[model samples]
Target: MNWLLVIVGAMVGAPLRYLTDRTVQSRHDSLFPWGTFTVNMAGCLVLGLLTGAAAAGAASSHLQLLLGTGLCGALTTYSTFSYETLRLAKEGAGRYAVANVAGSVAVGLAAAFAGAWLAG
Candidate 1:
C-alpha cells in the first residue's frame, strides 16, 4: 500500500516535472536552465513543507513517503542539474554555470528553510 502510494505520487510528479520544465524553458531565451531550476526549488520547498508538517504531526508517514520520497525524488533531478551546468561550462557559458550552481544551492536552501519554518 505504501509502495503503491509512492508509485502513484511518482507518476504525477514525473509528468508534472516534465511539463513544468518544458513550459518554463520555452519561455526563457537563455541557456540558464530555468526549467530545471524551478522544479528543483519547488521540490525542495515541497519536501521541506512535508518534513515540517510531519514533524508537527500534520502529515502522515504515508504522505511523506509519497510526496517527499517519491514525488520529490522524481521531481528534482540532481543529475540533470549537474549535466546542464557542465554543458554550460563546456559551451563557454561559464558564468551561467557558476550562477546556476551558486544560485541553486543558496536559493534552494533558503526556500526549503522558509517552507519548513512557515509550515512548522
Candidate 2:
C-alpha cells in the first residue's frame, strides 16, 4: 500500500517537475537555473507544510510517504542543481553559480520556515 502510494505520487510528480522546470526556465534569458531553483524551493515549502501538518496531527504517515517521500523526492533535484552550478562555473559564470548556491540555500530555508508557520 505504501509503495503504491509512493509510486502514484511519483508518477504525478515526475512529469510535473519536468514541465515546471521547462516552463520556468523558458521565461528567463539568464544562465542561472531559475527552473531548478523554483522547483527546489517549492518542494521545500511543500515538505515543510507536510511536516508541520504531521506534527500538528493534521497529516498522516501515509500522506508524508506519498507527498514528502515520493512527490518531493521527485520534484526536487539536487543533482540538477549541482550540475547547473558546476556548468555555470565551468562556463565562466562563477558569480551566478555562487549566487545560485547562496540564494537557493537562503530562500529555500525561508520558504520552508514560512510554509511550516503557515501550516502550523
RMSD of each: 0.6, 0.6
Off by over 4 Å in 2: none
lDDT of 1 by residue, 1-120 (tens): 999988988998999999999999999999899999999999989988988898899999999989998899889999999999999999999999999999999999998998899899
RMSD of 2: 0.6
The lDDT values for all models are: 0.95, 0.94
Worst 10 contiguous positions by lDDT, candidate 2: 4-13
- Score candidate 1 by lDDT: 0.95
List model 2 lDDT by residue over 20-111, tens digit each.
99999999999999999999999999988998898899999999999998899899999999999999999999999999999999999998
Check candidate 1 and list the clashing pairs.
Answer: none
In model 1, which range of ten residues has the least summed lDDT?
Answer: 47-56
What TM-score does each of the candidates earn?
A: 0.98, 0.98
Compare the candidates by lDDT and give the number of the best one.
1
